[model samples]
Target: MAIIKHAARQTLGQLIGANNPVVTVPDDSQRQYAWTKKEVDTYWADIQKFRLARESGKESASEYFIGPIVTITDEHVKSRSLLDGQQRLTTSTILIAVIRDILWRIGSPEARSTASNIQRDYIARKAGRREPIEYFLVLSLFDRDFFRDFIQDWNELTGKVRGVEDPKKRPSHKLIQEAYSNFESKITAELSSYSDEDSRLDWLDSLYECLIKGLVFVEIQTPTSSDANEVFETINSRGKDLSTVDLVRNFLMERSREDLEKQRVNDAWRVLLDKFDKREEIERFLRHFWVARHGDVKSHSLYATIRGDLTREFDKRPHAYTAGAFAAELESASIRYVDLIHCSTGVDEFDSALSEIKALNADALHPLLLAASEKNDYAQLQDLIEACLSYYVRWTVIGRRESTLLEENIFEVAKEFSGGAGAESILRRVCGWIPDNETFKVDFEEASIPKPSQARYLLEKVEAKLRNTEGVDELEVASSTKVHVEQIYPQQPNPELRLDEHDSWVHRLGNVTLLNGRKNQTNSNRPFPEKVSIYEESALLVSSETQVFRLWDSQKSRWRPEGIIERQADLAKTALTVWPSSSQWQ
Candidate 1:
C-alpha cells in the first residue's frame, strides 16, 4: 500500500538530491497542462488566504504550506514527479529569475552566480547542467498547452521586467510576483550595500520552499477493496470538495443511480444540455451558477466545480457554458422556482386567518434584508434564515413543493421568492445579519398555477415595508411582480386592419389596479371593449378605490402615439410606489 504522511516527516528533500535520485516519467504523462487565466486567478486567490493566515498572527510567515510535491516509485528507480503542485513551483522559478536578472542588470557581482546556480541546480535543470533534464518531471492531469503557456509567458514577462536597465512598471498579479518585482526594482534602483547573492537567493528560496513544504494535502490514496468514485465524493463533501451541481454534472455519467426524475436531474445531463452550442461555456456557466449558489464558497473543490473539470478541448467544443446555464436555468425556472412560488389555481381568497398566521416571519422579508442597516438588535436573522431553509427542506426535498406545503404557508412564499435560505442568508449576513445552519435544497419542482397564498405573502410584505416608509400608509400601498397592467387599447398595427403602433405606455404597471372580486376578473383575460364595459359597470369599484392597479382607455387605438403617451401620464405617479429610488438601480 502507498504510504500517506507529511513529506517533511519522511525526510523527502534529502532523498530527492542524495546520490542522484533516478526518476522515470510514465510514458502516458505527456498530457498537456491546461490552466487558463481564470484558473490562475482562482489559485492565486486561494494562496492569498494562506498568505493572510500567516500574516494575521495565525501562523508564522516562515511556516506556510505551499503544497504537496508527489513522487512515485517505479520498478527501477524512485522517480520524483510533481503530481499536482506545479504553478507555484514554476512561478517561484520566475521570481528567482527576475530577482537574478535585476541584480545582473545592475552589475551586482554575485547576482549571476547565485541566480544561475539555483536555476541550474534546483528550478530548471532538476539537478544541474552536468545532469540530463530527465527522471524529474512536473505535471498534472492538465493540458500540455496550458502548462507551456503558463511557464513560458511567466518566464518571458519576468525576464523582460527584470532585464530593463531602469525598471518602470510594477507587476500586478500580487503577493509573490508583485513582491519579486518590487524587490527587484528596489535593489536595482538604490541598494548598493548588500552583495550577498547566496543569502539573498536562499532567503527567497527558503521562503518559497517553506510555503511548498508547509502546504498540507489530504492524500487521496487509492484504497483497495473500495470504490474510487465513492472516495472522490467523500473527499469533496467536506466543503473541501466541489459544488453539488458540479459534482452532479461530473459524475452524471458515473451515477447510474441519481434521483433523475425528481429534480429533473437527468435533464441537466440530457435534453437541455444540447441547447448550449458550446461545451466550454456550458462548463463555465454551470460552474459559476453552482459556485455562486453556494453562499460564500470559492473553490473548484465542488465535485470538480461544475464544467471546470472538463478538458480544455471539450470546453472549447462549443456553446458549453451557454448550454449548461440555459439548461440549469430552465430546469430551475420550471422546477425549483415553481416549488418556491408554489402555484395553485385553486387558491383561497384573501382571508385574515391565513394572513395573521403567515405574518410570523415578517422579519425574514427581503425588504428587511435589502433595506435594513443591520444593527446589533437585529432579531435572530439566523433563526429566520434557518426557518427559510427549513421551509425548502420540508417542501423541496421531494419534487414539486408547489401547491403543497410551500403554498400552504405564506412563510414559504417569502423564503422561496428571495432565493430561499441560501440567497437570503448571504444577503442578510453580508448586510450584517448573523447566519444559522440549515441545509437548503438547491433544486425545485414545477408549478402549473400561481399560488395565491404565496402571492398574498409577498404582497403583504411589500405593503408592510412600503407602509413603514416615510409618509406611506398601508391603505395606499400595493404589490406585484413581473405582472404588468396592459393598455386596454391594443398597441401595434394589424396590417390588414390598417393600424398604427400604439405609442408609449402599455404593458406598464401604472395602468393597473388592485381590484376586488368580479371587477378584477371582469377586466382581466379580456379585451378593451369588455374592460371598458366592466369599468363603466363598476362605478363603485372605480370611485371607492384610491389606487388603480389596472386601467384602460380605448381612445389611443384611433389616435396618434401622443394620445397613448397622454393616457399613460397618470401611471408615472403610480410607479413611484413600487420601485424605490436607488443609486445603482431605479
Candidate 2:
C-alpha cells in the first residue's frame, strides 16, 4: 500500500484494483460531475503536447499521474465504481475516444489495429473475449448521458456523424455538419503537425499529466458497508452545490421545538428565499444589508442568537432584530439578465433616490456598495468608479453609482496631480480636486475625427475655479474658457462633395478648432485651401500652415470626417484603453 506514479500511456491493459497503492481508478459516482467542454478541450490539447514531447525523445518517466487502478470486472459489474480521480479518468476516456476515432479514420494497418485494440478493451461487449481499457477503467461507471454526449461530440468532430439540414426541421442539419467539419479540421490539422505518430501520442499523454497528475483528491476506499448513507451525503457536499433551503434545513440539526427564535428565523428565510426565487442578486444584497445593519450577517452563525432555547441555556438576550418583509423579491433571472435582479420594483429603481433598491442588477454598483460598506476603503471606491466608467464607454447596462464626475472632482482635490495614459486620467484628478460636483461636466461627443468614435469630450468649468486661484469668482472672459471645437472636416462622408474626385480631404473636420469671435467669422465661409493661405500670412502664428494641417490630420485621422472606417481601428483601440469602467457619467 505505497503510493507511486503511474504513466498513463504505459499500456497496462487491466484495472483489477490490485491492493497496490501505485495505481487506482476513480469511482463512477464522482464522474457524474459536470466537467465542461472547455475544460475537456484544454486537457486534450495538453495531451497533444505530451505526445509531441515524447516524440522529440524527451518523454520522462520521472513524471507521471497517480490515478486509480480499478479492477473493471464487467461480468459481475454490480458496482461500476472508480477507485481514484474522476475528473482525470473521465477526460482521458474522451481523449482516447478521440484518438481511436482518428486512428480508425487513418485506416492504416497500425492505426486500425490500435483503434480496434482500444475499442474492444474499453467499449466492446464480450467481457472475456475483449481486453479491459488499459487506462482509467474507473470512469466507466459514469452516467449514461455523460458518456453519450462524449461519444456524440466525438462523432461529430471525427466525421462519423453525418449531419444534414432539412429545411426547418432542426436548423438545416447542414449547419451542424459544417460546424462539426470545421471543428474536426481544426483538431486534426493541429494533431497532424507532429512529424511522428509516436510523438503525437506522447503529446497527448503529457497533456494528461500536466492537467490531472498534481491535483489533490479525497481517496475513498470502500472496505466496509456501514454508514454508507452518511458517506454519500458528506460526499454530496463537496460534489454538487446544495440549495439554500437544503443548506438551511441542515442548519436545523441543532434546532428543537423549544428554540422558537431559531424556528422563526428559519421560516422567514425560507419564505423570503422562495419568493425571491433564488435570485443570487437579492441574496447578495440581503447579505450586505445584514452586515450594514447588524454588524453580523451570516444566518447560520445567528441560529442560536435567534433561538429561544439559547435565551436561558446560553444567556441569550432579546435583541431587537427586524428584517423588512423578505418575500418581496426575485431570486433568479435569465442568463441575459445575469447582472440584473428583480425586486418588487423595476430595473430603473437603482436610479430613483426615493425608490428602494428592491429589484435591480448588481453590476459595478453592487460591488462598490459592498466594498464601501464592508471595508470602507478608498481603493475599492476608486475601482468602482473605474468599472462604472468602462461600462459607460461601452454603453453596457450593468449597474449605477455616483457620477465619476463627482468622484473625479474628489480625486482632483486630494492634493496630488499627475497625468498620463490619456487626458481622462489627468482630467479626472483635476476635476475631483476642485471639490465642486456641480461644475465638472463630461460628455460623449463625436469629434470631427471620422468614424473613430474615440473620446470626443471636453472639460470646462465655471470661472469660479480661476476665481479661487486668483481671489475672484467672475472673470473678464465670462462663464468659462471658451475652448470650443471646430472640425476642419466633417465625420459624415460626402459622396456629393467628391469634387476632387479623389479621396483627398476626406479626413478634414471641416477645418474646426478653437477660435475667437472675430476670427471665427472671418474664416467662416472660406474653404481650408483658402484659409490655409491666409493663416500662413499671420506673423503672430508660430506654427506653419503645413504643420497645422498635419496636426489636424493626426487628431482626427487621415480621413477625418468622411471615410470613418479607415480611422476606426486606432480610435477604437484608444477608446477601449481609456474608456471608464462605469457607464453612468454624463
Model 1 is weakest, by summed lDDT over 10 consecutive residues, at 440-449
| Runs of candidate 2 exceeding 4 Å displacement | 1-63, 66-84, 108-113, 123-146, 152-187, 190-586
lDDT of 2 by residue, 1-586 (tens): 2222222332222322221222323221122323444554555565555546544665473333433332222223344344334445444444545656777676656666666655544432223436532222322222332343333322322434222222221111222233334445655877788988776665444443343342222334443222222343354445433233333233332222234544444454434433443334334444433332234324444333333323343333224322111111112111112222332223333322111121112232332233232323233234434444343333321112355543333333221211112334533543232222111111222223332222112111112232344454443322223423334443243454333533334333223332323435445444455455544553211112213453224443343333333333223333333433222332
Backbone-clash count (model 2): 88
* lDDT of all predictions: 0.35, 0.35
TM-score of 2: 0.36
